[model samples]
Target: MWITYFFSSLLRFISVVFYGEITTDFKPCIEFFYAETIPQGISGDYQALCQHYENQYHFATLYDRNRRIPLFSAYILSPGDGPRPKNTNWMIEPRLVSDKVNTGMEYQKHPDQNVKNSQAVNEDYKHSGYTRGHLAPSGHQQTEEDKEATFTLTNIAPQMEKFNNGPWNNLEDEMAERFKVCTSKMYVITGVMPYEKDEPKINNRVTVPEYFWTAYCCPTFTAGPDQNYFPTYAAVGRNDPNSKDDIVKKNTQDGHDVKEMSLEDLEKILQNRLKMPEMSLFKNKCKE
Candidate 1:
C-alpha cells in the first residue's frame, strides 16, 4: 500500500504512505472516489489509505497522520442489508505506524509499542469523554466485512457523545434513506473540520473535529426533481455544544445541530477554516 500523491510541501518531498505491500499504482481503491478522481484542496501532513479488510478493498480514506484523524473517507453508498454489528470492537490501521503491515488492520487490544505514538490506539479514547465516531459509518455498508472494515481507527475521529449520537447520527440515517431512491451510483465523502489552530485532542492523541461533515453525489435520481439531492448535497454538524450557532444552530434539546446546504457552501466554510482557499469535497466532474 505505497500511496504517493501530487501534493507538494516545504520539504518538496512526495507524499507517501506505505502499507502492508508495495502498490505500483494509485488505483488500489480508486472506485471509492467520484470519477476515479480524488478531491483536492487538502495539503499538509496527510496520507491516503485504500482501506482493506478480509482481502477486499472497502473504501478510501485520506488520513492526517499528524492529527491522527482521517481528513475524509470516500465510499460508494451501500446500505446495510442486515442489522448493525453488535458490541463494536475497534481496530488499528497498521501502516500509519509502520512501513510493513502484513495485515491491513489489527485489533488494538495489545498494540505495538510505537503504535500509540504514530496513531490513536484504543487507550487514547478511554476515559477521554469522547466517542470514537466513524467517518465511514458502519450502517452505510451492506456486507458484514465492509461494515467491520469501518471499525479501524484510521476512519475514526474523536467526537462528543451528544453530537455523535444526536445530529450526526440523524444525518447518517438521512443519507441512507436518500440512497434508497438513487438511480445512479452514490459517492459519499464524510469528513471533519478541525479548528483553525491549537485544536483539542482526546487523551492528547486524536484531534477532536470542530464539525462533522458529509456530502454525496448521485447524478441520476429515481426520486424525481423535488426530492433529488443529486448531483450533490452536503451538511455539517456542530461537535461542541457550547459553541456559537452562527454555522449550525442548536436545534435539539441538548443543543446539537446540523445545517444542510449546497456542496459549494460546505467547501467555502472548509476553505476559510483550513486556510486552504481551494478546500473541496469531490472532483470537478462530480457535478453537472
Candidate 2:
C-alpha cells in the first residue's frame, strides 16, 4: 500500500501511450499476440505474429521527454479466432493473459490487479503506489485487430512506481524523439521491476525483473544481413545486463549498453546464449 510519488511524470507518459480503450469480445479469453516468433528460452504453448495494428503504423506515444524511448510492450497478432497452431517443435510459448505463467501472481492477491476500463485515465492509477503498467503499448502492432490482441496478459511485466516514471520512462521519451528526428520507425519493448538486489525489500513476495531488453529496426535506415530494416536496438532493465543470468544480485548498476543485431542472430543468442525464450530488444549476459 506504500507507493512513491516521484515517478509522476513517467506514469503520465505511460498513461498517454498505453491510453485508449480495449473492448472485450465476451469470450473467457481474448487472443493477444499471434506469436509471430516463438520465444527461445522459456518453454510452453507458443505462437508468433503481430498483436495489434497492421503494416506501417506509428505505435501509441507516451511523452517522457527524457530517455527518448517508449516504455511499452507489443506483439504481432494473427487475424481472427481460430485454433492456435499446435506444434511441440515450436521454440516459443503461446500464452493466455489470465494464465498463471503470464500473470506473475494471482490477480486477486497481487499488489496491483490488471484493470480493464476505457473510462479510467492514466491519473486514475498513477498514485496507487503501483506502476501504471502496460500489458501492451505498441510498436509492431499496426492494425486495430493487432492492437486489441496485445491487450492480453502474455505481454505484461512487473514494473516499478519510480523507475516507471523515472529513468525508465525517459527511455521512452528518447526513443520517440529519435523517431521524429530521424523520421524513422522502430519496434520497442519496455518493462519494470519490484526491487533491486540491494534495495530495501518490499513485500516478501513481489517478483522483480532480473533484466529486460527490446529489439527494433528502422527500415528507413540500414538493413542488416538479416534484411530487417530497423536499427539494431539494445537496452536492458535494472536487474541484469549479462546475456544469460536472472539472479537478482547479478543485476547491478552501470546500465547495460544496447547493441545492434540481426533477427536471426537475435534469435540464436536468445535461444542458446541468453536463455530467455522470448524476443526482446534487451538482453543480459549470464556469467558461466
Candidate 3:
C-alpha cells in the first residue's frame, strides 16, 4: 500500500510539472474545482488555468492544449445584487502567453487550421458565426474586477448566437437569482461537451461544443421544505439546434433546449460523455 501510494503521489507531481502548476492565485479555492478525465491524446498537455485579474483568482479553467480552448471553468458565486457590469474587452491569458509548451505559430497564418497554443485572441472568434459564450458568467461575479476577469477569451466558447442570447442566457440569469437567495457561497462549474463524431470548428481554430452544462453546490442555505434540493442543482443546454434529442430534448419555446436536473444526474451525463467513469464536480460530492 505504501509503495503504491508513493508512486501515485510521484505521478501527480510529474503531471503538475508537465502541465504546469495550478496558478498560485487558485491555491486557496482549489478544493472547489473538480478533477476531470482529459480526453485521450491530450493528457500530457491539459492545463489547470486560474483566470487571474488584478492579482487575484477570479475563476479556474481546464484548458485543452491541443484544441487551444477551455474545457470548463469553475468559480464561486459571491453575494451580489443588481445588474451585471457591461461586457469588458476580451483578453488573452498571460500565463498561456508565457508557456513554452504552447509553441507553434504556424496556425496563426492559417485561420483554417487548428490553433495549438494556450491562448486565444479576438481574431479567432471574429465572423465565426458564433457568440463568445461565457463559461463563468460575469453576472455571478460580485466585484467589477471579477466581472472584467470573465471577459478573457479563455473563459469563452463558440456558441450559437441563438443559444447564447436565448435559453443559455436565461439559465445564467436563473442561476444568479438562485445564488442571491442562498445563505452561503455557491460553487459553480460550467463546461462544454464536444461532439462524439465530426466535431465542428470555428475559424478552424476552436472546436464548437455540442452541449453546455452547469452544476452548482451551495453547501449552506436556509433550511426549508426544499432543503433537500437547495444545496445542489445542475442543468444542461443543447448548443446545436440541428442535433437530435439523444442527450437533451429540445423545448418548444426556443430551439436551444435547457433542462434542469439534480447534480448526480448531471455528473452521470458528464461521466458518460467525458469518458470519466467517476466524474464528481464537487469534493466528495460536496457532502457535509
**Judged by TM-score, which candidate is best?**
1
Among all candidates shown, the one with the greatest lDDT: 1
TM-score of each: 0.88, 0.39, 0.80
Candidate 1, residues 1-288, lDDT tens digits: the string is 123333344224322222211122238888887887677656666777889899989999888888999888999988868877887788888787765765687786788778877788888899999999999988999899999989989999999998898778988998888887788889999999888677998777688888888889887777664374667899989888766776788777776689999898888888787677475567773664
At residue 114, give the lDDT of candidate 3: 27
**CA shift of 248, model 1, Å:** 1.6
Residue 53 alpha-carbon offset, candidate 2, angstroms: 11
Q: Go through the candidates in order and give each one's C-alpha lDDT.
A: 0.80, 0.34, 0.72
* Model 3 spans with C-alpha error above 4 angstroms: 1-44, 79-84, 100-116, 224-228
Q: Kindly provide the TM-score of model 3 when superposed on the true structure, using C-alpha atoms.
A: 0.80
Question: What would the TM-score be for candidate 2 when compared with the true structure?
Answer: 0.39
Error of 3 at 208 (Å): 0.5
| TM-score, structure 1 vs. true | 0.88
Overlapping backbone residue pairs in candidate 1 total 1
